[model samples]
Target chain A: MNWLIDFFGNAANWSGSDGIPTRILEHLEFSAAAFLIAAVIAAPLGLLIGHTGRGAFIVVVSANAARALPTLGLLVLVVLLIGVGTVLPVLIPLVVLAVPPILVNTYEGVRGVDADLRDAAYGMGLRGRQVLFKVLTPSALPLILLGLRLSAIQVVSTASVAAFVGLGGLGRFIIDGLATKTYSDVIGGAVLIALLALAVQLGFTLLNRVVVSPGVRQVR
Target chain B: MNDEPLVRWDWIARNWDNGGPSAIKTLLESHVVMALLPVVFGLLIALPLGVACARWRWLYQPTAGLMNVVYSLPSLVLFSIFLSVTGLTQSTVIIPLTFFTLAVLIPAVVDGLGSVPEHVRQSAVAMGFRPLRRLLQVELPVAVPVVLGGLRVATVSSISLVSVGALIGQGGLGNLFIDGWQRQFYTPIVVGIVLIVLLAVLSDGLLVLAQRLLTPWSRARRRTA
Candidate 1:
């Protein structure tokens, strides 16, 4: 416990590229980038399938299969394929890790909305896009947010693991510390990553409360 | 290293059994043991805890909250923390992995139990079945599909994560990734991924088969619905 305080309190650990602040930025950068990319690709596709009720079998099967992929193995393999010392290899696997939860959750969320509500919107003379956006999206907002939150947390944690392959993040502390046999560095890195994940979890929870409508929220 | 093909059958054959600790066979065995133990142990522990959570409404939230926190922490962090106490051993890997399995399984157990219809429980009570007998004989049997669903997730994730243990030098097939990366050889890394995925898929398939066999009635109800 004292080592944790000493590790953080030391002024030297706070200023360079090796510093805590820079690592946190790098960690958040990759996590956010990967998550956004996944959302862009997955969320719309999920919504389309959910609304049209088409190709769901493919989406669900692939998502579940993706869950079984080993993060470290995928990271290493991608790094090896693309050659290391670049950000793409690290980002690729994190994006892969982020996609399944978002895709599946979004698909399930939109599909789970009341069919009658969708019909009511269509009957009111709303076009396809409007019905999807106005009717289904709001009704499915909670689950979509839940999916995003799950993806974000998973991405954050895996991003740290990606540091093992020489990407810049808080995980550098753990990898470097482990390499140098410095226990304090390892512990400090582990603590910081855990704290970051918890922050992501809390952020999403707060976002859920703010973004989800009260009527929709009560249904949950 | 750049000149070498992506995979060398010769290298795989030669290193298949040099009698070293990092042999493919040895690593595969270690990986299976480390990955499976946690799922087995986690199920054992989660069943009662989940039942309790389901039985006592208040216990569900706190237990689920704690498990979520545990799940949120990356496996690497948990591995590092346990390393200090357990020291570079398989137990270090297995213990943390068990927490992960429990995190997934407990909620599953609780949810599975919850899925039992109120009428079903009432009928059991009306039949004079005690709580324990009712849970084991009636409620639990019905809960099989859901619990097994969670079990499949737990099993697959556990198999995948055991490889991350390699960072601490205990990673089973994960060691292959480290080995390949250090030597700039892609064979081991490729082999490792294939094997791990195969293991996960095989285990998941087995669980699905188990679910079908155990809950034949659930399938019938689904079809009719």
Candidate 2:
């Protein structure tokens, strides 16, 4: 317990590239990048499939296939193919991890929208894109937020795995500690990741309260 | 590229035993067994808890929240935490995975029980049935699909996660991964991915089959109606 406080209190642990704060920043950067890429790819695609009532096959199969992929295996394989020390190797798997829930949830959320509401939107002075972004996306916000919550925690947790490739992240603590037999470092790393994941979950819950429409939440 | 295939097909062919067994085969078997053990334990542990949650209603939120936190922790990190407590062995892998699966399975089972139609429970009560019998015979069978859905996710994801056990020098097919990565060969990596995916899909299909077998009345009634 004192070791933990001592570890944190060391002024050396608070600054520069090798510091705790830097590692945390690196982790957040990777996680944020992965989340943005995943959202950009998955959300619109999910909306398209959900809105048009098409591409169900892709969503179902891809989600299953994506879930089944071994994260470590995928990570190393990408690194092997792309050569090491690049962001793509780590980011690709993280993106893959984030994609399925977002895509599936967004698709289901949009597809499950009340048909009458959609028709009502169309009957009003709205066009197709407006109908989608305004009517369907708003209606699907709860589930979209649900997917985002899932992805946020997933990325935050998985960002630790990035340490395996000698990248900078909270994962570095665990991987390096394991190699050096530093029990405190390993425990600290694991605790930090657990706390980070929980924080991400709480943050999203708060975000949901603020971002999601009250009507949607009430329905939920 | 020097006539070397992207993957060494010849390696796979040579490794194939004459309808007997092989190293990869053993790796796969252990991989599968380790993955399934957690799900088996999780189901056993969760069933009673889930039933209690359904009956009490109050237990659901806190337990689910706790489980969600468990679910969010990365498996490798969990295994590392356990390594300190349990020492370097399968216990390290099993304890974390069992908890992780429980995190998801408890919610599924509880919700499944909750989803049993109100009229069905009412009719069971009216028929002079006791709670235990009604749970086993009436409610459980009706809840099979929903429970199985959660089980399928747990089983498949757990299979991928057991690969994290490789870091501890324990997971089955995952060993091939460490071996291949160290050697800088592509074959074992490909083999590991294929076998892991195959195992997950097969396990999922088996659960689906179990659901079908357990809930025949649900399907039959729908079909006949």
Which structure among the candidates has the greatest lDDT? 1
Q: lDDT of all predictions, in order shown?
A: 0.90, 0.85
- Model 2, C-alpha of B121: deviation from truth (Å): 1.5
CA lDDT, candidate 2, residue A190: 81
* Superposed Cα RMSD, model 2: 2.5
Model 1 residue runs over 4 Å out of place are B219-225
lDDT of 1 by residue, B1-225 (tens): 167688899989988887998889999999999999999999999999999999999999999999999998899999998988899999999999999999999999999998999999999999999999999999999999889989999999999999989998899999999998888889999889989999999999899999889888978998999
lDDT of 2 by residue, B77-116 (tens): 7987887889877778888999988998999998899789
DockQ of each: 0.72, 0.64
How many clashes would you count in candidate 2?
0
lDDT of 1 at A94: 87
Q: Write down the TM-score of every candidate.
A: 0.97, 0.94
